[model samples]
Target chain A: MSTIIDGLSLGSIYALIALGYTMVYGIAKMLNFAHGDIIMIGAYALFTMMNLTGSPIVAIITAIVVCTLLGIVIEKVAYKPLRGASPLAVLITAIGVSYLLQSVAQIIYGAKARPVTLFSLGTVKFGEVTLSLSALVTLIVCAVIMVGLTLFVKCTKIGRAMVAVSEDKAAAQLMGVNVNNIISITFAIGSCLAAFAAVFYLLQISATSPTLGSMPGIKAFTAAVIGGIGSIPGAMIGGILLGLIEKLCQSVTALSPYTTAIEFGILILILLVKPTGLLGRKRREKV
Target chain B: MSYMLETNNLGISFGGLKAVQDVNLKIEKNCLYGLIGPNGAGKTTLFNMLTGVYKPTTGSFSLDGENLTGLSQETINHKGIARTFQNIRLFNNMSVIRNVLVGLHNQPDFKCNPFVSMIHAKRHYENESNMRNRAKELLRIFDLEEERNNLACNLPYGKQRKLEIARALATNPKLLLLDEPAAGMNPQETAELMDTIRFIRDEFDLTVLLIEHDMSLVSGICDEITVLNFGTVLDHGSTRSVLANPEVIKAYLGD
Candidate 1:
């Protein structure tokens, strides 16, 4: 029971990150490889803001604003110009951006990992099952965000525009949708989610580093692929399942070191069985 | 007299290839105008230029006396020009109603802040319901109300074409461009479509420009016609005279 709770908490963080990945990929049709690095940048911003203001809420808000701006800038400067370029070229540029962000972080923060000051929300005990306050909070926040995002996409005009843009850019334009503005909005929302994920992620690990985002970033991406790359619910399911599996493996002493391998092995197996991922619909190209 | 759409010496060239050149067109308000041509006669290319899909290498065009040349496609759409592609390009994954709602997105009356939408505020709810009602009305007119919740890609071919027009109408366009709307329809469907086209022009008070290969449908509905051959206008006049022109017949049937 304790292990399951732990898994759920960890999975919630992965799900948050995966949501960003899936959304950008869905709307922009680009794998924003630097997305994980944005989480790192968010963590750094949070660390700096917390030190300056000594308030967790202020720090989180500042980090979100900063990361949102950064996401938009990165898109306008990097991705916008490459809109019609081949997918391979875009992928390479994304990789370049990831490295640039990491290098910039290293120049400012150095190579050492910095400990994050977590909010002392305290823990909860339900008989034999004990849940950390942060874990409980993470789960609630993740669920709320997921539901809110789903509703936003399903119910709102701007949300409908996003869906239309993703389906066909030219058609969306004819309907009076500014495709570039929509793409920027997608980046903003994805980066804002990354900032929130950074907070919970730091709370769980209690540490921050330039390279820290890379591991979790890759893991979250894996979760996205497992769930179906562009699906909202799929990301949640994949993240939680991955977290549970990892937690269960950690609970067994013998499988502790091999957990990463096992997770990837599962990813390979899932791909072989269902290349489009769990919730992904197969697209039929009209000839 | 001010025209609904006027292109003055409009043309575009790709390197040395003059795709569309020196095409001056005048379409009256509430007029049903037809653009008929052989394949590669640049009918679609002309439509593309009118909708701002391609920047004209020469000349200018205007909508209701407002110059719209060099503007972006979305801007042109916002200025009351909307179009459907030669190939049906509905938002395939979205529900039929949602496709119309997308066209309604830029309407100032339906605008709600993103934050308000997120919270499902009263303003957002009202705006949403209004847009939904409007979209439903459009779907109802197009006889697509029964399939309002179905994905657009799942709709039958003829219905899909109607939905595209419905979606375009949802934008509240003053000038509607239909590119070969009856391309794949049966005789019955094409006849029905012709009636729908005429009905919509009268009902919506819209000016329409369409490209078509179907002579019977074009002559059956279009009030005026322009025939193009080899990137230039061969004839422009009322439908009967234009269709009867020896030059137009030569363009269509060859020498």
Candidate 2:
């Protein structure tokens, strides 16, 4: 039961972050390799703000704003120029942007891990099971965000425009959707989610570093692929499943050491079975 | 005299090949004008230019005396021009109703207020229900209300074509551009489409420009027609006269 609670909290964090990856890929059709780095940037921003203000909410909001702005800036400066370019070229540019962000952070904060003062928001107990305060809070936040996001995507006009743009950019343009604005908005939303994920994520780990986002970022991306890269719900499902599997593996002494390898091995097996991933739509080419 | 849409010396080149050159058009308001040409005659290219999908190497166009020469597609759309594609580029994965909703979404009134919407505020629900009502009304007109929940890809081809036009109408366009709308339809469907086009024009009170290969449909439906061969206008006049012209006949059928 403890492992399940741990898995749910960790999985929600991954799910939140994976949503960024899936949304960027879905709408812009770019890998956005720098998405992970945004988490690190958010962490640093939150840490600095929290240290100065001693308010978690203010820090989280500031971090989210910073990440959103950075995401938009990076998209305008780096990705916009390469629109309609080859996937390889875009991929290379994304990797470059990722490195550039890491280098900038390294120069500013150095390589040492920064400690974050974790606050016990409150714990939840159900019968014999007791979950950490942070974990319960993280789960609640994730639930609210997920429900809100789903509603936003389904009920809002801009959200419908996003769907149209993702389906057929030219057609969407003909419908008077400002494709550039939509693209910028996609990045902003993704980055904002990343920042929110960072707050909950670092809460669990209680540390922030230049490289803090790397492991979780890769795992979330793996979650995205496992669920079906372009499907929003898929990312959430994949993240939770991955977290549960990893936690379960850790509980078993025999499999604990090889958890990462085992997780990746599952990815390989999944790819071999379904190239488009579980919920991924088969890309149809019009002749 | 003023025109709803006017183009002069509209031309484009790809490397050394002049795909379309020295094209001129003066489309009157609310006119059902047909643009007919042989395959590769740059009919679609002209549509692309007019819609801002491709920028002309040399030329300018105006809609209601407002210059639209260098505007983006979205801007052109905002300027009240909407179009359907040659290959029918409906959002296939989206439901029929959702497809129309996307078109209805561009209204300034429907602009997102994330904070209100996130909380499912009264205003958000009001705007959403209004948009839904409007989209459903459009579907009803296209006889697609019954299939509102079905994926666009699952719709029959004829229904898909109608849905495309229906979606275009949701944009509330002043000018409608239909590219090869009747291309794959059978004789019955083509005849039905001819009536539908006429009905839409009369009901919507809009100007229309269409590219088509069906001579009978063009002659039967269009008030005026322009004939093109090798990207240059061969003739332009009333549909009856253009179709009867020697050059237009030769363009369609070799001498």
Candidate 3:
């Protein structure tokens, strides 16, 4: 029970962050590979602001704002100019941006781990299982954001525009969609969500480092691909499944040493069984 | 006299191979114009130039007296000129109505707040539903209403072509450019499309320019026709006159 709850909490956060991946890919069809690093950047933003001001709320807001801006900048500088390039070019550029951010962060933050002071570790018990207040809060916040995101994509005009761009860029262009602006907005929103996910994860784990984003980022992308790369609901489901898998693997006495291996094994299994994903649909090229 | 669209000495060459050259045309307001020629007579290239896809080698194109030589395609589209490609390009994964809803999104008057857009904006909701209805109406008019919720990829080949035009009309352009409204359609489908084009023009109050090869549709529905051969205008006038011209006949059908 404890393992399930813990895995779910972490999985929820990964799912939230994976939305960033899936959403951006849904619109741009390019893997914003640097998206993982964006979460790291957000964590550091909170860390530096907290260190400077010692005010938790201020730190959170500052981190979110700065991360959002950084996301916009990354899109404008790194991704936007390379629009319409091959997936390989964009993917490599995303990796380059990830390295660039990691290096910049290491240089600035001194390459040491720091603890984030979330509102203290409190817990509530359900049946025999205990849930940390931070974990509970993370689940709640992620739920709210995911709900908002779902509605935004479903009910909003810009959201519809993003859908259109994803569907047929030329047709969207004919419809007067500023494809560039929409793509940039996609990155900004995805990055902002990644940052939010960083804060959520840090709240549960209470530590920060320049390289902290790497593992979580990979996990979230895996979740996204597992669920369905271009699907919103798929990301959520994939994330939960991945979290459960990770936890279930760790709980087994014989498999405890193979947690990472199990995570990878699931990915391999899913890919070999279904290339697109469990929920992923096939896409045909028109343009 | 003023024209809705004008291009002078407009031309483009693909590595010294002339794709379209010395092309000039004036689109008067609210006229349903047709550009017809053989399969490779640069009709698509000409459409590309007018819509700011390929830059002309040595000519100027203007929309509403605005110099469109350096403007981006988005800017040109924003200025109320929109186009569809010969290859049916719809957001394949997107729903049919959302594909059309994307047109109204080009205008960024909506507040960037996801909160407002998600809830409590009556105008946004109303306008959006209205837009959806409009798209539905278009699809229904084109006999695609039942497929509004389906992904664009599932549409039949002929319907996909019409959906592109419907999606294009969603942009609310003063001038609409259709690359080939009958690319993969049968003779019966092309005949129905001629009436559909006329209905779309009048209903939307749009000036239409189409690239087509179906001489029956062109001569029957086009107010005027321009023939291009080897990237140059071989003939231009009323459809009967141009089709009757020996130059057009020889270039298209051979001597």
Candidate 4:
């Protein structure tokens, strides 16, 4: 039961971050290289808010808003201009953005990790595992966002436009979708999701560092790729699978020290078994 | 009287190769117009320019007296021009019904409530029944209603072609462009496609411009034909006249 709870909790967080990766990839067909760093930025935002106002709610809100804007700006400045460029070029630019963000963060926030003191309002005991209230909140919040996002994508006009763009950009544009705007919107939403994930993460971990986004970002990315880069449900599945892999490795005999390695092994195995990921279909070419 | 569509000195080039150059043509509404040419005749190039894929480096195009130049395909599509590719491009992963729903994306957002909008219950379902009814009707026309629930990639080659046409028609365009719509079909499929084209033209009240290499196919269906060769219009007239023209024959048959 505790293992299940641990998997579900961590899985939810991974799912949130993975979604940002998946959504941006789906619409733009570009893997956002800076996405993990974007989460780090969110952590800094929360840090600043917590220091200045000392309110958790304000900190969370500021984090989401600031990260959201950062994401949109990143798209406008970095991703948008390279719209028609090769995927490799865009990828390199993403890496540049990630490093740039980290360096700038280090200059302002410094290299030292700060401990979060905002956990005074929380503790939840369920079964043998006493889940932190903040942790549960993080899990629920992510689920809510996912549910809302799924509805928006599946039902709305802009959502249809997004689907159309992903299906065929040229054709979608011919349908008057404002492709550039749609792409920007996708980035903004993805950034906001990552931002929320970052804040939730900081609340749970009670720590923030300039270079903190690296591991979470890599894990989320692995989740996205394992879920199928361009698939939403696949991201969710991938995140849960990744979380389970971590927990299972930690709990299993003698693999506790090799937790990260075991998780990576699962990702590699999934990639080798199905290049397109779990839910990704093998697209056929009409010859 | 306005020609339903016209191009004035239209030109496009890729790396100075000039795939299409200074081409002019016109079509009346509700006409089955044929654009015939041999390989590398730049027929598809001209279509690409008109559809806003490769923007024209020079000249202008108008549809129903509206300047179609400087328009993206979707904007032009919104202006009631819809098209199929020379090679089929379907939303391969999505089911056939969802594919058709995607076609009607621009049908104006109705029923704006958070619950329905969020869950897509009201907003998602709004006009869905009617859309499905229409989708069924289109499938029935193409004899594909039976396969409406299948993945587009799962369908047979002939049915895939039909699905493409049906999906495009779901957009309800005033002008329809068919690019080698029957390229990979058998004789029986070709004949059935001809009938389908005619049915669509009359049913949708559409003006069509087609690019086809099959003389029998084009001549069989088109009322007027324009032949292009080496990026220039070689001849334009009734299908019989264009087919009989020595220049069109030499360009096509090379003897």
Index of the highest-lDDT prediction = 1
lDDT, candidate 4, B18-115, per-residue tens: 78888888899899999988899998888788778878998999989999897777778778787888877777766776676677666543324334
What are the clashing pairs of model 3? A167-B91, A168-B91
Q: Summarize candidate 3's per-residue lDDT along A40-127 as a digit string, tens digits.
A: 9888888777778888788788878887788889888988878878889989999999999999988987788888775576888988
- Model 4 chain B: weakest 10-residue lDDT segment is B108-117
lDDT for A119 in candidate 1 is 82
B192-244: candidate 1 lDDT, tens digit per residue: 99989998999999999999999989999999999888999999999999988
* lDDT (Cα, tens digit) per residue for candidate 4, span A56-149: 8898888889888998899999988898999999999999999999999999978999876655646777666776666567668778888888
Better of 1 and 2 by DockQ: 1
B-chain TM-score for every candidate: 0.99, 0.96, 0.91, 0.94
The residue-by-residue lDDT of candidate 3 on B37-102, one tens digit each, is 888889988887777667778788887677788566777788878888787777777777777667
DockQ of each: 0.89, 0.83, 0.71, 0.42
Error of 1 at A46 (Å): 1.5
Docking class of 1: high
- Poorest 10 consecutive residues by lDDT, candidate 3 chain B: B107-116
Per-model TM-score versus the true fold: 0.98, 0.97, 0.94, 0.91
Model 1: DockQ score: 0.89
TM-score of the A chain in candidate 2? Answer: 0.96
True contacts kept of each: 0.91, 0.84, 0.86, 0.43
